[model samples]
Target chain A: AQTVTQSQPEMSVQEAETVTLSCTYDTSENNYYLFWYKQPPSRQMILVIRQEAYKQQNATENRFSVNFQKAAKSFSLKISDSQLGDTAMYFCAFVTSNTDKLIFGTGTRLQVFP
Target chain B: SAVISQKPSRDICQRGTSLTIQCQVDSQVTMMFWYRQQPGQSLTLIATANQGSEATYESGFVIDKFPISRPNLTFSTLTVSNMSPEDSSIYLCSVEVRGAAGNTIYFGEGSWLTVV
Candidate 1:
C-alpha cells in the first residue's frame, strides 16, 4: 500500500512571496507519479502540477513547481509570486504503478495574506 | 484537461434515505472514479467506474453501500444507499486524462452531502 504524507497542517504566505509545502510518500513501485492538487472553498479540486519518477527534472507550471527527489521519496510544491487566489487547501498525492488510484495526503490549508 | 461537472452540488438527506450523485464529462473518458472526502481528511477513492461494466471498489468499500453506474464513456453516477451521518461527506467525481505518464486524474466540484 502506498501512502502520502503532508506534515504541515496549515501554512501562510505573504502576497508576492513564495511558500513551499512538503510531501513524502512510501511505495514499493519503482515507476510512479506524483501530483499536487488545490481545492478552494468551492470544493473543486484542481490539478496544480505533476511529476514523473523517471524524470530527473522537476515539473513547473507557471508559479507552481515541484521539487521532486525520487531518492528521498520527497515531492514538494513551491508557489512563487504568490497571490491571494493561491489560498486554498493543497494536497499531495501518489499514484502507484499498478493502479490508477491516487493516495492523497491529509492536506495543508494555505492562506495568502495581503 | 477534461471539464467535469457533478449534479446536486449539495444536498441534505435524511438518515436511511439515499442520494445519487451524477458525473458528466465534457468529452469521453476511459475511466471515471468516485471519491469521498471527510471533513479535514484526505480524499479516499471509493471505486473505479468502468464504462459498460460494473464498478471496481476499493478496500473498505462495497457495492451495496455505494452503487455506481457508468452507462457510457462520458457519464457516471454514484449512489449512497442507506445514508447515515457517517456517510455525510463531500462526494467527488473524477476522470483520468491521458498524460505523459499514463493518465492524470481530475476531480469535479464535490457534492456535499449532509445527513441528519
Candidate 2:
C-alpha cells in the first residue's frame, strides 16, 4: 500500500512571496506519478502540477513547481509570486503505473495574505 | 482535460434518508471514480465505477452503503444509503484520461452532504 504524507497542516505566505509545502510518500513501485492538487473554499479540486518518477527534472507549471527527490521519496510543491487566489488546501497524491487510483495525503491549508 | 459536472452541489438531509449525486462528463472516459472528503481531511477513494460492470469498492467501503451506477462512459451516480451524521462529507466524482506520461485524473466540484 502506498501512502502520502504532508507534514504541514497549515501555511501562510505573503502576497508576491514564495512558499513551499513538503510531502513524502512510501511506495515500492519504481515507476509512478506524483501530483499536487489545490482545493479552494469552493471545494473544487484543481490539478497544480505533476511529476514522473522516471524523469530527473522536476515539473514546473507557471508559478507552481515540484521538487521531486525520488531516492528519498520526497515531493514538495513550490508556489512563486503567490497571490491571494492561491489560498486553498493543497494535497499531495501518488499513483502507481499499474493502478489509476490516487492515494492522497492530508492537505495543507495555505493562506496567501495580501 | 475533461469537463465534469455533479448535480445537487450541496444538500442537507435528515438522518436515515438517502441522497443520490449525479456526475456527468463532457467526453467519454475509461475510468470513473468516487471519493469522500471529510471535514479538514483529504480525499478517500470510495469505489471505481466501471462501465457495463459492477463497481469495485475500496477497503472499508461497501456496495450496499454506497450504491454506484455507471450506465455509460460519460455518466455515473453514487447514492449514499441510510445516511447518518458520520456520512456528512463532500462526495466527489473523478475521471481518468490516458496521457503520454500516465493517466491524469480530473475531479468535479464535490457535492457537499450534510446530515442533520
Candidate 3:
C-alpha cells in the first residue's frame, strides 16, 4: 500500500517570505510520481507542481518548486516570495506508473499574511 | 492542457434524492476520474472510468452509491444516489493528460453539493 504523509496541519508565512511544506511517502515501487495541489477557498483545485521519481532534477513552476528526495522518500514544496493569493490548502499526492490511481495526503492549510 | 467543465457548480438537494454531475473535457482522454472531498478534508478518489469498460471504484466506495458512466472519450458522469448528509461534498472530475514526461491528472472546478 502506498501512503502519503504531511505532518504539517497548518502553516503561516509573511508576504514575500518563503515557506516549505514537508511530505513523505511509503511505496515499494521504484517508478512513481509526486504532486502538489492547491485548493483555494473557492473550492477549485489547481496543480502546483509535479516531480517524477526517475528525474534527478526537481520540478519548478514560477515561485513554486519541489525538493524531491527519492532515496529518502521525501518530497517537499517550497514557495518563494509568497503572496496573499497563495493562502490555501496544500495537498501532497502520490501515483504509481502501474496504477494511475492518485493517493492524497491529509493536507496542510497555508496562510500568507500581508 | 485540456479544459474540463462540470455542470451544476453548486446545488442543495433534499435527503434521499439523487444527483448526477456531468463532466466534459475539451480534448479526448483515456481515463476519467471521479473524486469526493468532504468538508475541510482531502480529496478521495471515488472511481476511475474508462471509455469501453466498467468503472473501477476505490475501497470504501461502491458502484451502487456512485454509479459512473463514460460514454465517450471526452465525457463522463457520476451519479450520487440516495444522498444523505454525509454525502454532502464537492464532487470533482479529473482527466489524465499524457505528456512527454509522464501522465498528469488535471482537475475540474468541482460540483459542490449540500444535502439537507
Where does candidate 3 stray beyond 4 Å? Answer: none
User: Which candidate order results from sorting by TM-score in descending order?
Assistant: 3, 2, 1
Clashing residue pairs, candidate 1? none
For residue A47, model 1's alpha carbon misses the true position, in angstroms, by: 0.4
lDDT of 2 by residue, B19-112 (tens): 9999999999999999999988889999999999999999999999999999999999999999999999999999998877777889999899
Of candidate 1 chain B, the 10-residue stretch with the lowest lDDT total is B96-105
Per lDDT, the best of the predicted structures is 2
* lDDT, candidate 3, at A18: 96
Per-residue CA lDDT of model 2 for A7-90, tens digit only, reads: 999999999999999999999999888999999999999999988899999999999999999999999999999999999999
User: Which run of 10 residues does model 3 chain B get worst, by summed lDDT?
Assistant: B96-105
- Give me candidate 3's TM-score against the actual structure: 0.98
Q: Scored by CA lDDT, what does every candidate get? A: 0.93, 0.95, 0.94
Candidates ranked by lDDT: 2, 3, 1
Query: Least accurate stretch of 10 residues (summed lDDT) in model 2 chain A?
Result: A94-103
Q: Give the chain B TM-score for each candidate.
A: 0.96, 0.97, 0.97
Per-residue lDDT tens digits of candidate 3, residues B1-116?
77999988999999999999999999999979999999988999999987977899989999999999999999999999999999999999998888898978889999999999
Q: How big an interface RMSD has model 2?
A: 0.8
Clashes of each: 0, 0, 0
